[model samples]
Target: MSDTTAYSKKTMRVLLYLQQGELTEHQIYSFLASRVKDEQNSSVLRRIAGEELGHAKIWQKLTEKEVKTNRIKFWFYSLMALILGYTFVLKKMEKGEDKATKAYRSLITEVPQAKQISEDEDRHEQQLLAMLDEERLQYVGSMVLGLSDALVELSGTLAGLTFALQNTRLIALSGLITGISATLSMASSEYLSAKNSGDKNAVKSSMYTGIAYLFTVTFMVLPYLLLESYAVALGIMLVVVIIIIMFFTYYTSVAKDLPFGKRFFEMALISLSVAAISFVIGILVKRFLGIDI
Candidate 1:
């Protein structure tokens, strides 16, 4: 009754690899379950963790191999859940699972149970993950509002300042002052808007928006602070802007089931376009005003 002759050596190797991955994911889900505060959410996580273990056991029976969980990935994902919110981590993990799906497809025809497990892994698990209630996700709109405005507005400001002031230190100082004032203004506006809309979490939403805006401002201005050359700082800041766009786009794409490439390109295009236009305006202003500062 052993599966020794059921699969070839190569097939067994693939199954064993999947076995370890499933076990590792199971541990990750279990750890995440322990960290979640909501009892219903915890129950859902535990249910998924049990299913992941069940999938690992299926692979074990097919391969007749004992697998150890990857402790490093376990800890890494656990940390990600804590820092990035469990919904974000799970969405990221689901993307990673796409690679494993190919491996699972290989066993579907060969192993009868593979079909059900594959379906569960691809469809059921994802649906359940989508159902998980995470507070941060609910406030994603506020974060997006803050982050996007900061990126476009501040990137344009820095681009103009770089050309106009032509001094890294001066630009950094000006950008920080501008960014701080804008952050406060943005937070207040969000609070008022949310409150007018009858949102009970108005303060929390504003906090998320302000925090996101401030974080973006800090990154966008960092190059100016570190570098002495205005041109070099501007170039590095542009690169930082693109990176921030990519990271946020990917996060939203996965968590919200949106298209990554389209969102990324659109945001990049708009932000850079604003910067380009502002740069031109800065040149014009500098020439006309004849400011030496």
Candidate 2:
């Protein structure tokens, strides 16, 4: 029997879709392998790329149709790898394969090779996980410490100052002074903590923490600097705080394979709760002292 005659139209379409997906993944892996600096990582990518091509060929034989690689997805993943690091982009691609694996399992009765293909997909994820070794991921803890502290501390400080001083310029000035001092202190603390723990990358880890903290501080204080109204600036700053938490939490979650919703909500709650308490204290202090600026 001919290849097309062996299956229904629906099955043929599914095979074609799987073939195209595998081809696209092959292209993406090949491109990443060429660009990766680490020899071991490049070797693993090349092996995976070859396996993907083989899988595509298997599907092609069954579908009896030549599938084209998805250029858009190929370039998108390439760009992401360049900007976000190879490990992150590769992990994201693996996540896409997870859905494909389920589809493959469903086709096991229609195609005997489907079970093997699904197993291969599962193996690819394991291989990628074992081989990935990105420096940024290594310093994620430091970044988290710096980012979380800055968000909570600066958000609260700015909220209090906004209510107490009721002046954008004074708030901005005070926030910057507070942020800078805190950045230095946090960096030094990270440095000492890493050193005590005998971490070889102590200096780099501390730098990552400090940079993350300073970056958060800058965004939080930007609205106050640009706007004249303290209340409006505080509102914008709170929005910025939420955004920073959302973004950083997502990055860490994706890179580390952790739960996104849990971490995001937890961090948001802590930061906003501190800001709310500080806002009330600012009002009480201002009213009690009868101070007006």
Candidate 3:
């Protein structure tokens, strides 16, 4: 009927996409946690675990009617809904806010509700943006984060392994094995995850994520071959890994546009969880196989 009605109607769909982003992003840390083994990674994962749930909840404020309407499709509906929501509602809200700020005196009187909500939305959006420093943050679209994924996990894994091992050949071998698998798995997951990202930015994000994964794994593993000792190699790897993860947290905060502190805290938790799992695996393997080397 009216422009306002049309906008509101469309928002119902847009909110869905926002929700999906929150839901899917939550998976990265756990998937990685399942792969890495050690204290650092475990600690990272534990932090991530908290962020994932919180992130998901950020856009989870749908009324009962919204959920029931969404439930009708049931399969891939949430994903599609999120895509629409982030693009439409979020963007529109942003636009509406801008329009409200510049609304003419005459129009403001007639469309006061629009003016008011637009201001509120603008404030909300800016709040999200102000939470982080972009320069320090990593670009978290698929590509940026994909690389981040590989870098942190592979680096941490190699670092831990190098810490325990003495042989150079084995160090490289372990990195090689882990890197190849991490790249492929991260690439696949990122691409599939792009289903929710219809925009060009989304596609690029996915590609960046894959590249990040590759670089992350290689960056840490490459050093071990050079240094020759597991301890030295692991030390170098740990420093680099921390730098990378910190960068990733910053990137995610900036790119997704959230608070840096919040992002760091969350990622730290996830890393820890992953490392813990890996440690448990290591313990079991050591006890059962009785392999000492």
Give per-residue CA lDDT, model 3, range 59-152, as digits (tens): 3544122222223233243343243322222223333333224432223454344345445434544554243232112334555566546655
Question: Each prediction's TM-score against the native?
Answer: 0.95, 0.92, 0.45
lDDT of 1: 0.90
Q: Tens digit of lDDT per residue, candidate 2, span 7-86?
A: 87777878998999989989998998898788888888898888889889989988888978899999999998898888
Winner on TM-score (1 vs 2): 1
184 in model 1: Cα distance from truth in Å?
0.2
Using lDDT as the yardstick, the better of models 2 and 3 is: 2
In candidate 2, where is summed lDDT lowest over 10 consecutive residues? 120-129
- Among residues 3 or more apart in sequence or in different chains, the pairs in candidate 2 whose N, CA or C atoms overlap within 3 Å are none
- The lDDT of each candidate is 0.90, 0.90, 0.52
User: Which 10 residues in a row give candidate 1 its minimum summed lDDT?
Assistant: 107-116
Off by over 4 Å in 2: none
Worst 10 residues of 3 by lDDT: 63-72
Cα-based RMSD of candidate 3: 18.9
